[model samples]
Target: MTKDQLKLRSLILTALFAAIIGIMAQLFIPLPLVPITGQTLAIGLAATILGSRYGTISVLLYLAIGAAGVPVFAEFSGGVSKLVGPTGGYLIGYIPTVFIMGLYLEKTSFTIKNAMIANTIGMIITLIFGTAWLKIAANLSWTAAFMTGFMPFIIVGLVKAFLASWIGILTRQRLISAKLLFPERLKEKDNKVA
Candidate 1:
């Protein structure tokens, strides 16, 4: 594929993943501090499939859409208020989460173990940002922030990370086989040690 083709294909995939994140955001159980959401699963899936650059772009696009007042956040919430609201940090946390996950998969061969490791690390980063943000945004104690934002979501996060690792890698493999995500999708930058 030409450079333009590669760029276009990546953009399309990025847009698709952004929509996936938006859709997944709606599938949630609302809570006072933070909603139980599938957004992270979708983020993991996007990172695994699109790799770091495009994955992060996809997440940025998702945030931009939500901040622009589109109803693409949890419980169909959107607008700049939502981005600055109590749960905003969790949303902000996705930046590093998707970037690191995709960067790891890009550098290493994709495997169940590697995928899980990437996703788990990503989740931890999200939790750190989210929990901290919960405390500041909601005016809660650290313990309250942890309990409301981190503790309750631990099991669910693990499950989502596992599911994302398994399903994302499999789906990416299939797409590669089908040629839609070939070439660029499997690219590893040539590194020469001097």
Candidate 2:
């Protein structure tokens, strides 16, 4: 394919991944303060596969879609109210997560081990934002916020982080090997015969 065509394809795929993250967010298991879900898994996966810039843009697009009154959020709900509500912190937390995960993935080699570590750190950062925001919004103590918004998600988040990282990195590696992306450096080492 031509270079311009390749860029267009990449843009389309990035947008599709963003939409996927938004859709996956619907699988929410409601909690007291912040509903827990595999949404972060999607975010991590986006970051790993798309790298930092595209991944972050995808998340921003997802947020924009939700903000524009699309019912794409958890429980098929969306509006400005949700964006500014008590759970808003968690929603906003997603932005930084994309940056954190994507930026880390950009700098590091893709591997199961690296993916796990990077995703773990990213998730922790997101949880910190989510829980802290919950604390302030709900007027709860730190302990209370942890119990409601952060504690319940600890085990599951860890598992999802690792799993998502693995899947995303693996898929991206395959895509690079297939020459789906233009720049050869985008591929993982094994795919480059040179």
Candidate 3:
């Protein structure tokens, strides 16, 4: 593909992933502290499939859309107020979450171990940001915030992370087969061979 063609394709893919995140957000199980949503799964998919740069771009785009008063968040909620609401921390946390996952998958071969570790780390960072935000935004005590935000979601988060890791690596393999990924990676391999 030509340079411009490659750039266009990348742009389209990034936008698609951003849309996926937005759509996935609508699938939420509302809870007291935080909504159990498919956002993390989409985040994992985008980062694993697109890698750091494009994954980060996709997430930023998703946030921008939501910040623009679009009803794209969980339970079809939206607007800038959502960003400052109790759940806003989790929304913002998606940025760093994608960065960690994408960076790890970008540099290393996808494996259950790698994906789980990276995802676990990312989930921790996201929860920390989320819990802190809950305390400040909702005026809750640290223990309260932890109980409400962190404690409730641990097992589900692990399950989602595991699913994301498995699905992401599998999707990447399909992308490679379709010639939609691994050009640069293949080039690196060829360079080593030569």
lDDT of 1: 0.85
Rank candidates by TM-score, best first.
Answer: 1, 3, 2
| Cα lDDT tens digits for candidate 1, 136-183 | 999999999998989998889899889988888788777776766753
Tens-digit per-residue lDDT, 1-194, candidate 3: 78778777778889999999999998889897789999988988887777778889999999999999888889887889999999899989989889988788667656666777778877887889899999999999999999998998889889988888778777766776686664355423221200
For candidate 2, write residues 16-92 as lDDT tens digits: 98789878988988865577776788888987777777778888888888889998778887887877877777778
TM-score against truth, every candidate: 0.93, 0.90, 0.92
Q: Which of the two candidates, 2 or 3, achieves a greater lDDT against the reference?
A: 3
Error of 3 at 115 (Å): 1.2
Off by over 4 Å in 3: 186-194
Clashing pairs in 2: none
User: Cα deviation in Å at residue 178, candidate 2?
Assistant: 2.7
- Ranked by TM-score, the better of candidates 1 and 3 is 1
Positional deviation of residue 110's Cα in model 3 after best superposition, in angstroms: 2.1
